[model samples]
Target: MRNRLKSNEGQNRRKKRTSDVEPVFGHIKSNRNFKRFTHKGIKKAELEFGLHALAHNLRKKVS
Candidate 1:
């Protein structure tokens, strides 16, 4: 929808990868804001991703 990210092309053309990132992303989607992070910048994006990863790892270890 946004001009910055092409929808049909991005969703279909991007190469899918197997990694822990997918499961972590699934858990993070419990929050609506996370479904589409509005931040603008590599540092901010990295921080948000790192926080999600940290939460996921902690939950996995405790459970």
Candidate 2:
């Protein structure tokens, strides 16, 4: 694991992956105040996350 992280290709991939998704989650957690879900069941939790993801996508469209 340490050697892979130290490799040039691995470092590039890691930077690209984190840059792509980190901001979206940071925005969701900070701006949307989505620290935790209120729903209990698996189905409800899925629905809740789906809604939140949809909202995030819609915001992207508007901006």
Per-residue alpha-carbon lDDT of model 2 for 1-63, expressed as tens digits? 989988998899899989998888788889999998898999998899889889999999999
Q: Which consecutive 10 residues in model 1 have the weakest lDDT in total?
A: 11-20
List per-prediction Cα lDDT, in the order shown. 0.66, 0.91
Question: Model 1, 11-41: lDDT tens per residue?
Answer: 4444343243565566678743467656789
Off by over 4 Å in 1: 1-21, 30-33
lDDT computed for candidate 2: 0.91
Each prediction's total of clashing residue pairs, residues at least 3 apart in sequence or on different chains, is 0, 0
Which runs of model 2 end up more than 4 angstroms from their true locations?
Answer: 40-47
What are the TM-scores, per candidate, against the unseen true structure? 0.50, 0.71
Show the colliding residue pairs in model 1. none
